[model samples]
Target: MIVKRPVSKSLARAFFCIVLLSLLSTGVALLTLASSLRDAEAVNIAGSLRMQSYRLGYDLQANDPQLALHRQQYGRTLDSPVFQQLHHRWVPMQVQESYALLHDRWRQMDACLARGDIIWYRQNIASYVAQIDSFVLALQHYAERKMLLVVAICLLGFGAILLLVFFTLRRINQQVVAPLSALVEASRRIEQGRFDHPPLETRLTNELGLLGRTFTRMSGELEKLYRSLEESVAEKTLSLQEANRMLEVLFHCSQALNVGTIDRRCFRHILQLVREHEPVSSVEMAVGATWRLQEGEALADAPWQTLPITMQETRFGELRWQGETADKPSPQLMQSVANMLGRGLYFNQAQKHTQQLLLMEERATIARELHDSLAQVLSYLRIQLTLLRRAVPEENRAAQGIIGDFTRALNDAYQQLRELLTTFRLTLQQADFPAALEEMIEPLRAQTAATIQLDCRLSLLALDAQQQVHLLQIIREAVLNAIKHADAQEISVSCVSAPEGHHAVYIHDDGCGIESVNEPEGHYGLTIMRERAERLGGALTISRQRNGGTLVSVSFTTLSGEQTAGRPDNNNDDND
Candidate 1:
């Protein structure tokens, strides 16, 4: 493995330069001081020459025999290593000259001592001593200069070291301290979830610089990751909200369909819920071939998405939505709604069937009770009146006439009771409103040679059971009135939606119009018809047409549509 060395411009290199400068300065100072160590010793040896000269002069004056020994000692002292160093080339010129002169004087003194020339030796001894003093003074000056040189080297080295240390410290602050501080601050920023701090310093060639660069890159990546995480979280939150909305809509749909009878209003309410929750412009539902419920604007040319409403493999119809293509509902949600609608339809059919059965059973009970009670009583009263009339005498014509009136009234009452029984026993017989109407008219058609036509447009109204019954009774009574009283040759029964949100039933017969508005005695056909119309929350009108016919018309509203009213008893007799 190749390990990278630190660059020369690094903090370590700066410190190394400072240390090297200090070492060089100290070594030079020590070397200069060591070279001047012998200067003081040389001066001491030179000063002793004065003492040796005095000793030799005294020996010559006193004729001492030990003078020769002292002379040898002086020669040895003059040739000492410390004094000989003055003759080398590094010595000052004045010091060298003084040493040469002192050496010459010493040799002359030694010669004079051997020749016994006391006068010459004594006269020149003081001058030779002066020359030795001059050599010592020169050596002392040289030693002082060496000391000053060492001091200068020490000061220069100290100054250079100080300068280098200052620069090195500044470099360390820039390369290490500043970058470290930035990195620490960067760490804090990241901790605080902020990644937009100032740029860090990476220009340096040290470890700190590399760390700064790496940290910068890491922060960039972290910012990207954090942004991505934020985006993901936002998306998840939106998805959760959408899911919650969808669940709420589905829950409401279930609530609406949970009823026993699902009407157009319920289906319309479901469509309204979808419109509120979804981004739809309009919505519509088609049940069977004729029933349709819609909410919002009806745009015929708008593109629509259709979902089949099916349950148990029986498709009730289709649900359609009109809006922007991008605003389509979830297939799963729409399908679920469709399935719920299908189930509701199924339940509605079953409930209607049950209600029809119950209605028929109640009607039969009423008819049976009437037959067992009112009819039997009416028949017995008619027989008793007949026998009493037979028992009455031919005389007393007023009483006889009264008996005849009573007998005729009894017969009319019995016939009316039988008609009531038949009407009470009538049922829908698993037929729709139109079919029931047709069945009621079929018998009347035989009673008249005139063509009896039935025109019905009640599909759009979708009348409930009570509505169907009241409407059927009203139409049947009008048709019977025309057949019995109007003497019409042609009759038409029509049921259709009227303007201003109402349904109207019309029974028109082309026959001689009624001569009087008041019904005769014991006849309540118009009264009963008006009462039924009032029960239906409508107005019934019997008017003579200009073409010599009577028109009986009833106009009313539906509960699910514009208007409605409380229902009357379903067992009301069709007395007409």
Candidate 2:
């Protein structure tokens, strides 16, 4: 049967020991005191009897001369004076009854002496002396017996005290010390993650057993906490790894799209990139207030047509896409993609404006081909050189020397090419919204092993191409930010129709949340996100979740009836 242990065995054992010892000591003391009292009583009785005998003999002497002479001859006078002094004091009535026969014998002797019966007096005196001697002997015997009883009691008390000490010590060792030692050992085992044995059992029904039960419960809790800690650590490690992979993917995507200006081909390339990186179910694009696809060819109902695209009197087209309805994207992933899209849009637009300013669209076109083909090949070569340099051992002098020279040349060329490309890319216009967002997030999705669900619920057909681009950029930036910063395992991106003919993009993630830094300088992502929203005539809201993760939302009003009526062939894609 399972039984709860006492809480404090040691304390109970100590208390019992103290009580037992006290009782034993008290008993011993009482026994010793009683013995001493009995001894004193015996001594007093013996002395009183001796005094009575002498007093009787002395009183008889006057009344019975012959008896007195006989007493003298028998040597009774030797102790007569001491007895006379004792008899002068009052005797207790309880002892007087035992002395009545002696008193009568003395009177008889006195009477005989008064009658002058000398021979009879002598005979009676001798017999009376014998009786006095016998009484004295009996009192001595009683005193001796009382002394013996006291001694016996003293011995028994000592033995009992010894027994009590032994039992107390034994109980303390068994119930207290032994169990404590076992508990310590068990704790050590548990610390080492070995929870093999049942906790030590305590039979005692006192406090010690209670303590044992408590320890067992504590051990169980500790074990659970340890396991949870391990699991949490493992989970965090996996998340960190996934984040790193996503960053790598983002980096590569940035490198790929960095070479060109915004164009229809770039937009198509962005769609292709998204399709390759993630399992996007549909892609739609709008340009210059027109849908890219024909009316009958449109895939779904466009939702972005009603959203406000003009921000500070500037118009940017919107693009929308949709993914499988069964899957939902995490907020972090959506945020990351959003941020990337915003940057891509800015770059593509700048590239396009540069092309217009130069008035050398054809030259720019040839330059792009050269840059894409040769520059990519050279970049690949540089990457190989970097790997080779790393592979060369430090101790290998010949290989290190060759590798160092090759690496320096490659680094210098790569640096020059990178600078030239950056300048060239700066001249290019930003890609439309759909292109930029798609370009930014594709790499992130490809690099990480995490499953991503992308949902772009905006309608491109009903709105002008510029509004579509704006909405697409907003969604992309929000999604990318979520993926990169929130460290989310899953991201959800959703766009719903808002009141006042506005559209809202909501990005939510299930990951470690962004720190709620009140200052803009503390969080660059939030600052950038806010800036993008403001520039688009939209508001950005970022909030941390209580359970874990971040939620980013952007909402903006679309143009009124005149702008909506301007686009007659608007097609909305419902990619749910």
Please list the C-alpha lDDT of all candidates, in the order they appear: 0.78, 0.55
> What is the Cα root-mean-square deviation between model 2 and the actual structure?
27.9
Once fitted onto the true fold, the runs of candidate 1 whose alpha carbons sit more than 4 angstroms away are: 1-23, 60-68, 84-101, 108-127, 148-162, 235-361, 378-415, 429-464, 478-493, 498-500, 508-526, 543-550, 558-576
Model 1 CA lDDT for position 114: 83
Task: Say which candidate scores most in lDDT.
Answer: 1
lDDT of 1 at 226: 97
TM-score, every prediction: 0.71, 0.36
Residue-by-residue lDDT tens digits, candidate 1, 1-576: 121434444656777887888899889989888888887788888888889889988898899999999999999998998877776687788888888888898898899988889889868877887788888788889999989988999899999988888877787787677888999999999999999788998776667767788899899999999999999999999989878888999999988776656666677778888888887788888754555777788677888889998878977688998874566777777878888888877676566556666766777888898899988998888888889878888797988999899889888888777767766676765335676678777877888777889998765236666666667777877787788878788889888764333778888889898766677888766777788787677888888888789888998766652233233445444323
- Please list the residue runs of candidate 2 whose C-alpha ends up more than 4 Å from where it truly belongs after superposition: 1-137, 152-249, 260-327, 349-576
Number of clashing residue pairs, candidate 2: 91
Local lDDT at 459 for model 2 = 37
Which pairs clash inside model 1? Answer: none
